[model samples]
Target: MDLPTTLAEKIAALSDGPGCYIYKDAAGIEIYVGKAKNLRRRVASYFQARDGHPAKTLRLVQETVDLQVIATDSEVEALLLENVLIKELQPRFNIKLKDDKTYPLLAITREAFPRVFCTRDRDQPEVDFFGPFGSAKELYRAYHFLMRVFRFRVCDLDLREDDPGRRSFKPCLNFHIKRCSAPCTTRVSQADYGEDIRALRAFIGGRNKGTVVSSLRERMKRAAGELRFEDAARCRDQIQAIDRLKERGRLRDYDEPAAPTIDIHAGMERLQAHLGLAAPPRVIEGFDIAHLQGTHVVASLVQFVSGVPNKDAYRRFKIRGEAGDGDPGNDDFAAMR
Candidate 1:
């Protein structure tokens, strides 16, 4: 590929609209994928020798093999297509976005007596999961608080009730530490455990929304009025649970948007007049390339669920092909297969 003599001349030649543009290197390998509101102007930016562009742009101008474009109705559509193309081809140059941390997740199994605990993977099949929690310690503190307040199980469920090897009278260490409700002791009935699990879900969801706190105080007053010291002790624990919720709220505010219907996938409307075609596919995968002085070019994929970035489903690729001379070609359309 050879450099086109004049940069402004190319801009004067482009038609304005939504589309994908390709930039190639000297050997004619595409190294970058980009979208444009106006083809000519967008393409010309790279060729502006005096524009003080970055090294990537400079390389783009020097080795750009050819120009290609695909006109679309809108920039939004162009953005959608841009993401698709870059991901498939993994063009040498593109911005990268990353999310790479595992936090404690709450998982509740589908059973007569469900268990609640922290997990990291969001892909558990039979359990409900919440969170890509920010920090393990914060999550653990929250986990332990929930366990103490909720009295749910905190030990392995694999041991059989009649397993001969199992100690008939021995309780797990966690039970001794007050982390477990000592369910293994047979002292906790299934019905009672079920009640605890329900309360826990409500607490984690932050419902009762301070109602728990108010209820506990009222109960403590009633118990004290009746001179029932044992009932008052129970109410005190509820008060502490309220305090735990307050502290956790300060870190991860549970002010989530109204939860989406798990059934409906976004962008899957059955009919739309604008498309003049079938409903657009709801699932979208966005691709991006990021480079640092052409030294490290990274490709990224962002998976969207209902037009929202589900950060848990993201991946990044390190690019090495055609990145050396700094001019990574940007043919996103070809990458779109």
Candidate 2:
């Protein structure tokens, strides 16, 4: 079928609601993707005789060679489909929130001990995820809090029960504070700690954070009543730890959303705006070296103007110093300066 000649005609023909829409340029390349609560009302506004349209929308309407709509049963379904199309087409006018952040989620392995740790990817088939939390700092804070309350192995050591030879290895630091069940050396039997892990994951992911801590507190009281002082003490300490962080407002019952960003400078313009320097530094070339103990040293630098790093002006420099060398200096004042 032939395309509509005028925006008015196309918008008038659109159905009432719940769908995804695409705006294409004359070349038939998709430039925009959008969703509508009321397709006819929304799309018609674009061609409503200019006064109702902003210059941006006007330009879009003027250049839009054709428009298309896919009807859906619900707004949420339209939203889902809109996301699908936008990702597949990578349309120019669509706002893409591109943030590739490697944040932490408490993962429980399918292993005998059911280890826990901070991980970013959702690839672990054995365990469920609790978050793409705000920051590593936040995750570490929660991690320490959890460590004080519960025991789980978080090391990267390849210690397995089937292999008895690894059992002779030195104890991990986590053993001292009771942070880890120490699967590496079999300090705690896998079956016992496995139960701890299941409860821990549930408590963290539970709708009410108090439920887990409350249950622990009850058990602690029961142990004390039963004349089991050591077990009572352990449970008491865990309750206190949970209470402390809860007071500090760091014990999150629900996870925070992930926010990720990458810094890119097309030129000094953006960098200048970023630094807020009275003026973009002259020849604002920054260089740094990356290496491990006198190995693999490389440097990167950027130029800035009007408070921006001009990417077209970016330069990469190779480092001549050893790892942990010239740049950091390990000198206090020098470090700050």
Candidate 3:
């Protein structure tokens, strides 16, 4: 491909590091945002033979007039940065998450004997919602798993521990089968039940599965040392459950593995060298023009600090006058100015 001297120079300056690349059109609008293990290879690949590339890739390359690169320390950091930027920028070419709206969540009711269930809407703020998960089936499966593992209350019977009628209330099948701790009959004290709740919280609070298991194992060892057999047993069971979930591949994607550290200083220095700047640029900003068939022309300005997005500094502008006049080509420069 015959490329412009300036664009070629810019591409040549790209570093060999894990990072994200932002492609922009002639109007300085970001059309696509992508990440790569090696910035030089990945971004350069886009400009190579159009014959072998996909139709989408061809179009992207054809329209790309300018680009920005943000280097990270590793592929994991690049991946995480890519996700955050994509969600924040909502670029035109990227494959987006279908459901932009919040999904159904699993909540534990804020009651004396909390009931765990799934619901679409959050009516009460006090109750804890574990997820805004991708699907109800997944959430329910998780809920059922929790039910089997924790054996907390799932019934609606309002039998208080102190109430005289509590003695008259008969044990349900759940109690007989050992599903519930039978809190109504004081089979499980409030303190013990609260410990179960704490464990459940730790399991679901976006902590890495391995980390959770390791912590549980440590707790189990400590409990054994202190001769707390019951607590030790509970911890051991939790660890086993985690192992089972791993074996079954039922541990959902809520808990993500830890990403590698991003070398912001090195990224800034490399970017500076690539851009041929006199000094390392402390802040970088991106401008994008968005429109549908020349109507409703608008601009998005995204700011970055040392190669990372500074979301708070982002701004949007509605193009007016000549730029907004439904022209064949919108004037992004005029709008930005």
My TM-score estimates for the predictions, one after another, are 0.36, 0.39, 0.42
121-167 in candidate 2: lDDT tens per residue? 77868676655544565555556556656767654344466768445
CA deviation > 4 Å runs, candidate 2:
1-103, 157-170, 184-187, 218-231, 250-337
Candidate 3 per-residue lDDT, tens place, 1-337, comes to 5776667788999998767899888888888888776789988998887799999889888888888888764443344456556656767887533234456766787776676666777676668865455446555555656655566775444545567644544444455654556665645556667666666666554333455677778878988998878667766876776666533433243232233212233346667899999987877898988877766777889886545455668899777656455433465665555
Give the alpha carbon lDDT tens digit for every residue of 1-337 in model 1: 4356443355567786546776656566667778776777777667655458877676656666666566654443344355456555566665441133354555777664566666676676788765444345555555545655656654334434444533443554445544455445454445545655665665554324355456567867887898877556655875775565423422233222233311122123422344565655445698986666654566889775434344667898765455344335354332232
Best by TM-score: 3
Error of 3 at 77 (Å): 20
lDDT score for residue 228 of model 1: 72
Off by over 4 Å in 3: 1-102, 159-170, 176-178, 208-235, 251-337
Ranking by TM-score: 3, 2, 1
Superposed model 1: Cα runs more than 4 Å off: 1-104, 158-168, 213-235, 244-337
Relative to the true structure, candidate 3 reaches a TM of 0.42
Q: Considering only N, C-alpha and C atoms within 3 Å, which residue pairs clash in candidate 3?
A: 29-288
Better of 1 and 3 by lDDT: 3
